[model samples]
Target: MELKPYRDNVGALLFNGAGLVLVARRADMPDAEGAAGGWQLPQGGVDPGEDLRAAVLRELAEEIGTDRAEIIAEHPEWLTYDFPPELAGRGFRIAQRYRGQRQRWFALRFTGRDADIRLDADSHPEFDAWRWAGIEELPALAVSFKRPIYEVLAQAFGPLARALASAAKSR
Candidate 1:
């Protein structure tokens, strides 16, 4: 079988003032995979000609119901990850269109209170539950296929995460 092109996507690593990264439990993962309740960072496809910055912010609002965050830093390079064969054509509608995702990740500082987050804000909620987690915990919490990307993110964003945590503690 010929491999398809990767889908253009954006990912958000929303860090709260306390320096914890936001993760959400997918509401639609297949139970057979035993990853039905797996957690992941907020991510979504980028529209044609849409700015990456805009796409990240839009995805944040659409997925978690808040755009009150501000961009702090962005991954210097795009990261690509392929879907595990079992997940191909079984997860997102985008799965039917592409082999996997080529994502531009961003670190955003959550500027609003937890009350500002509304999982039900969208007609179709992607996540059933959300929480702030330590950045190092991302890889283990993410699904197997997405683990590599989350691992890279944890390293790339480590210093920034630490600085934010320090700032929060000082306040």
Candidate 2:
């Protein structure tokens, strides 16, 4: 067996004032899959010549309808995951050509109200529904292949989320 190439992708861990992070259900995911928790953070391919930070914000706005955010931190390194073989040929943009994603993750603090989120903002929307979920719940909510990434993020961003939530409470 040979290793396949990965797509260069940017992912967001957008945190609200309440400390919960944003996660969205894929528009293409089946109802049963959605019910089984087919949710993930806002992410997308990095457009050629786009900066990593710019890509993250663009994905947030394109996927969730708002880019009102400030970058707090970035994951120290790129993380990679494999696409499950069973998911091949299903028409997922990321799965079509790439083995999976070589992801650069960022932590962003959402600066806008919940009403700012419009799932239909993009003519080709990536997600259908979204919600603010506790950071600890991320791993459980992620697809099996992406669970480890979510686990890492939960540990990596947990402190910042708490701090932000606390700060918001005091405001």
lDDT by residue for model 1 over 38-85, one digit each (tens)? Answer: 899999999999999999999999999999999999999999988766
TM-scores of all predicted structures: 0.94, 0.92
**Which runs in model 1 stand beyond 4 Å of their true positions?**
33-35, 89-92
Poorest stretch of ten by lDDT in candidate 2: 28-37
Residue clash pairs of candidate 1: none
The lDDT values for all models are 0.91, 0.88
* TM-score, structure 2 vs. true: 0.92
Give me the runs in candidate 2 sitting further than 4 Å from their true place: 31-37
> Ten residues in a row with the worst lDDT in model 1?
85-94
